[model samples]
Target: MNTKGHCCPKYVILQAVYFKLRFTLSYRDVEEIMKIRGVIVDHATIQRWVYKFMPFIEAEMKNRKARVGKSWRMDETYIKVKGIWCYLYRAVDKSGNTVDFLLTRKRQRMSAQSFLIKAIINNYRPRVINIDKSGSNTAAIKVYNRRSFSKIKIRVLSHL
Candidate 1:
């Protein structure tokens, strides 16, 4: 594949993408790091590289089959994006393998239901789902169980 671009080498572009993703660094931070390595590049260029390479990376990742466990731990947390608060729902298996994640604007039952549905569909049905004592999550699980034939056990943890 043509990894090299007109202005930067493939290694430099991949380094910027790796820095931006593997760490919580901004595009400007990645640019600064590349500059420290004597590679002059703009933050916008780095952003473009990330946007361009992400789809290919995701496709490569999806090609690999994941061996996730049957017991899953689900939770939701608030994240700020562009100064706006959003909810991030995440699920991990018993071995701490990432099952799935969904970002949404609302923290209601519908949001929880959608997140669970997506997780289940993507990672396959789990035997047991552990969650916090959230009423929305509980209600969403109930709704999911009612609609789906494969019933999953829900375990509410007092502290997550």
Candidate 2:
């Protein structure tokens, strides 16, 4: 909070954190912008704030008092990490809020299992999972004791 390079210490640091969250901007860019606004904080300080706050943000996102609804839409998106295509799995609850997410390179049994494990462990497990019609999903359902909708009401999903 000793950010006294002509910048109001708290405002500059708070703006840097807010900007980083709202937009995927680099720490240095955020630092420069704060400097332009008459605030002077190092990029490393911004990085530290983000690193410390990210977990709390994720936890708040995951542990809402409302469990949303039973219907869950699960999907995988492709993103480049280190120039490699990484599969990011995500889910939206019935209320259309993001529930959980996972990132992995392999779309195999282990990846699916880990995603499900996290979802189940951290929050309410969706009663219905609407994932793509893929072999991995098929195996995942089996591995996690999920069944077709006509089967188990607690862990039913699409017949893929």
Candidate 3:
């Protein structure tokens, strides 16, 4: 294909980058497949494309859908970053796709509420929230539910 007038290399590269993200494929694998199709590209080039186009993709996707849907599930995991404890709360929608995430220093009621509020700001507030029996989660829900705010939140707790 010759682009004598409209090359649109940005569009072409964005398409390739989106393909990589959709499948979560490794860079080397993408490079090899593109090479097999006679498209000369490098894994480094793919990485560059990903870094360059991520903001645009995020903006567009956020514009299209800005809600976590009705049924959302949340879980927390602890990780040590540089020997400092970090708590990560990840929420997923009904279909199992991730909706929101939060990293905090404390695993208290405030942290849980912050994560929930962050998720609500980005996505629509969930009607049903499934969380563990952590006191933080329970407390956050109780506070939000009894609040006089415009959007009172209700959360359902479950554990293993």
Which candidate achieves the best lDDT against the true structure? 1
All candidates: CA RMSD (Å): 4.5, 5.7, 5.8
Predicted candidate 1 versus true structure: per-residue lDDT over 1-160, tens digit per residue: 3674359888777788889988979999998999999999999989988999977766766768587999999999999989999999899999999999988888999999999999887768889999999888888888999988658899999889
TM-score of every model versus the real structure: 0.63, 0.61, 0.55
Predicted candidate 3 versus true structure: per-residue lDDT over 99-143, tens digit per residue: 989989888889988887788778876777777767776677667
Candidate 2 local lDDT, 1-160, one digit each (tens) = 3345533455555667788888999999998887898777799888987786667666765566566566777767789989999988877787887777899987777787778768766666666777776566556756677543333133335552
Range of the 10 consecutive residues with the lowest summed lDDT in candidate 3: 1-10
The lDDT per prediction is 0.87, 0.71, 0.75
Clashing residue pair totals per candidate (backbone < 3 A): 0, 1, 1
Specify the highest-TM-score model's number: 1
Which candidate do you rate higher for lDDT, 1 or 2? 1
Pairs clashing in candidate 2? Answer: 7-39
**Using alpha carbons, what is the TM-score of model 1?**
0.63
